[model samples]
Target: MTLPMQVPIPGLPARVRIHEVGPRDGLQNEKATVPTAVKADFVRRLAEAGLTTVEATSFVHPEWVPQLADAEELFPQVAALPVALPVLVPNERGLDRALALGARRVAVFASATESFAKANLNRTVDESLAMFAPVVARAKAAGVHVRGYLSMCFGDPWEGAVPVPRVVRVCRALLDLGCDELSLGDTIGVATPGHVTALLDELTGQGVPVDAVGVHFHDTYGQALANTLAALQRGVTTVDASAGGLGGCPFAKSATGNLATEDLVWMLRGLGVETGVDLDRLVATSVWMAAHLNRPSPSRTVRALSPTHHQEQ
Candidate 1:
């Protein structure tokens, strides 16, 4: 009899919560518009496959992200799902739109690197935090849970190899601003295992609980899965991934998509960790989305497990 692949890493959680971001982060950067109905169906399928938290859409200006311009139409479709549907709000204006739409969970994105903040948000690092401060506070007062995303937590293409203290400072600020969870993002996929360990250790030293920290990684350097493993070993429970690796950063020039959910699920399952995700169903969802995007999924696991393959020119 053949044995199943099982590699147990020490001190890892028995289960992990995957925050699915394909419908939002993944689709925001697409060059083509994905219909709101298609986007809604995608989130519904993800929730049905056991992903509890799906980042539904961003309420940024339509000129900034024409792809997600239908946020108003999209939110109402998936808002009733039993899963947590968190939308990305760029500032207080975005928050107001979210509140009016009756969104119960939202996220505010910040950047650890000044270069990225200026390029992406047209503000300095401190200025962006100044922008998000009131948004997070008001959202909390309204009984909504906020997730804070710190981009370029490891390295920035403009500024190489970010220091741990810089990341910790921003993390502390976001927590102080009333964010219930922090998703530290390797926006350019420059983080390796050692960098991940040092940063997480310093977050502990700075009094941020491991449980309150999550990780978001891009596979620009193809290190997303490896970096996620390092985070998991350190007692980090929440992970951010897109179905079929369907994203790229418009600001971070060299960035690729976020880590694919299928790839992460495959590794987590092999390590004897439970994520409550149905792998086959997730893979099918990726394949379906790939057809709409007109490209083969960037996921290695999805490509390996897919029932159909389409050529990308």
Candidate 2:
């Protein structure tokens, strides 16, 4: 396998935490149901590959996301892993399911645009926040860390160009509700580097600390890595990525897959920014997963570095 030459960039963090979301966010969008056993192995592989934080699965009702219906069966399979495993809990009921299974970290999905809130959660922005408040509080009370995922932070399909202040207001609300961190999402993947800088600056201006912010960009416009670089330039260290570029928004037709972890790691490696991820092992893991899913990996780095790349070419 080949690797990028390490070159440190000025004004970027010395290390970044890659929040791997392949097992949950990635697989949830798949048309085929990935078996529970495979999902467990995927999580284990990610941990073994040095991803500290891996989102395991969602506790949402199975009818809504039939792909993650095995959250109950799957969490236990990898719960003993040394890495942090965060699960998505939509409401108190979902929180209950996760808590019962000993999930130490959970995430609540929010939308920066009303149109997306209505489409994804079937609630207005305020209503969805109201729904998450108790859940966040309960999770915190139980000594669990909570993450708030704010979707459509950059652009929305129905309501184009989401205002920065609107996103800050919701960020404040989620933080006030006891969320430890917020993952700002470009749900439609329309964000450019300038747009990313503007949002991060506005969030800081509105009193949201940069350390509590994470960027989750989709590759719809092929700007995820550029947007991520911008976020890093602004001192945002946590990033959300999926192995093999595995996920997209189910409710948002314009959305593409999440930023590929392999690609992100490759970039960070070249930048001499430590992510603690073993590139070779990570690529192999994704290749193994691509085989399980019966599709080629969408990740550019994975395709370029995998053992079968020469044959595929």
Candidate 3:
């Protein structure tokens, strides 16, 4: 399939969609609980950087993720922003909390591997989907857009390698249940470019529209960028990234964080894909967020651009 416009970079399509998940996914795993004001400011800076879609926060129980305990308060403030802010809803209770905050878009998550599904959500694969059906239905009825996340799509730490057919089955179920988009996640960052290509080929061959699929890759072995390029080659426009490379999976031991948004944007721009994101602004946001966390940015682009770190003439 051809894109609406010709992309300037070789081997890249015309346009790409980036879903910035720094505030939600990135900050959630931080050792320190970021102040609500800081979180709001971090999101505002991302918006200023020209990001259209941002995952602001998750409405899961505080006990599960102490960092997002302030979701109710934070949602209203973020909801008033001018961009698309989506929150993660694990179940009907979380969905109710999101709806109470007047959220217009919410995302539901499920795992492709049975071990991860049962361990993470306390339910089997099919049982988890059954639990999500009511949440999807209610969100649709409320005129809210719902995105589905399928974790461990490429490889699972517990199960080792997940079958492509299993991933396709979950994708089909989510799409059938009225999810606007399905985000395929490499939860453990073990996906190679060839693995990505194979999965995309299989999913597309299975009749899943390329447009409805989003690729979320982790940067464990520094292969996230290459895998992202592979997805782009397959015409998957939507990509999920975290500013400053902020989050790591607790379930997957030794797993690295999500792909850095700044680095991802840089690569996309170099490939002639229009992302509408300002590199300098993103760099500034990452630096600011890193400072708040009292840690250096995990983003390579940010490190290279740091004023103090730049080589002197």
Candidate 4:
């Protein structure tokens, strides 16, 4: 019901494409199983709210993430949506599952540190990359878009601050493996604006195009927006966010929820950056999801704008 005054910022991209991760990354770690139909509706609502790219679900084994076990059943439900629906694929098997469902876009998760590699993927950093190489290649061969998710780019709970060179090396490897783009992740939310700038600078210096990069920051330290601003200032136009701030790393205890889409949209709107999203519709969608999850929305913008906020007050 309220909007921030438009104030254009110099040196930022004119338009940003938000890669909404609510249905998949957001709900993947829920303690209880979210019904398949509900998940499908969530994706539809998000698309209706003008989110052009919504990650639908992951094809990881059910044992690894029971919350997304319905990927098979869920993908078909929302596959007809006009927006881009990307699915996460752990390996070739996961990619196979996604391909079977005619998924056009898929993502592979990688860790920048060995500790997280072992903790999350049960492999060394190289080993995990090796496992993903074939999957990326096949996805590319199938004419499907691929996104590589590099986690713990800023700080790792087990390894402490990750080196810029180390992150760059893994990023280059993912790009070499045929990934169309990479989402740099601050899984623990420990990144500051300076850290974000340094990483982007290093990546750009190492020949990683800024336009091919996306940022995925968590809110553990309340720095998601700041970190995102840094990325935007560096010319990155793709950002990963979840509705209602609904996900955390199941493998990394220190990790928290991904950056909130409503929060990001609010900031972008104020900055006069076009995201092609309807702020009112987006807030309402998050509020409806919060009701389904039986928890208040963690996004400040969602809470401030939702009609229920006044009712509760």
State the C-alpha lDDT per candidate.
0.91, 0.94, 0.89, 0.93
Error of 3 at 212 (Å): 0.5
Query: Which portions of model 4 miss their true places by more than 4 Å?
Result: 310-313
* lDDT per residue as tens, model 2, 1-313: 6788887889999999999999999999999999999999999999999999999999999999999999999999999999999999999999999999999999999999999999999999999999998999899999999999999999999999988889989999999999999999999899999989998898898889999999999999899999999999999999999999999988998888999999999999999999999999999999889888888899999988875853543
Instruction: Using lDDT as the measure, name the better of candidate 2 and candidate 4.
Output: 2
Candidate 1 residues lying further than 4 Å off, grouped into runs, are: 1-4, 311-313
Q: Clashing residue pairs in candidate 1, if any?
A: none
At residue 185, what lDDT does model 1 achieve?
94
* Candidate 4 Cα deviation (angstroms), residue 202: 0.6
Model 3's alpha-carbon lDDT is: 0.89
Clashes of each: 0, 0, 0, 0
Sorted on lDDT, best first, the list reads 2, 4, 1, 3
Candidate 3 residue pairs that clash: none
RMSD (CA, Å), each prediction: 1.8, 1.2, 4.0, 1.2
In the range 1-313, model 4's lDDT, one tens digit per residue, is: 7899999989999999999998988898789899999999999999999999999999999999999999999999999999999999999999999999999999999999999999989999999999998998999999999999999999999789999999999999999998999999999999999999999999999999998999999999999999999999999999999998889888988888989999999999999999999988988888888878888888888877775763553
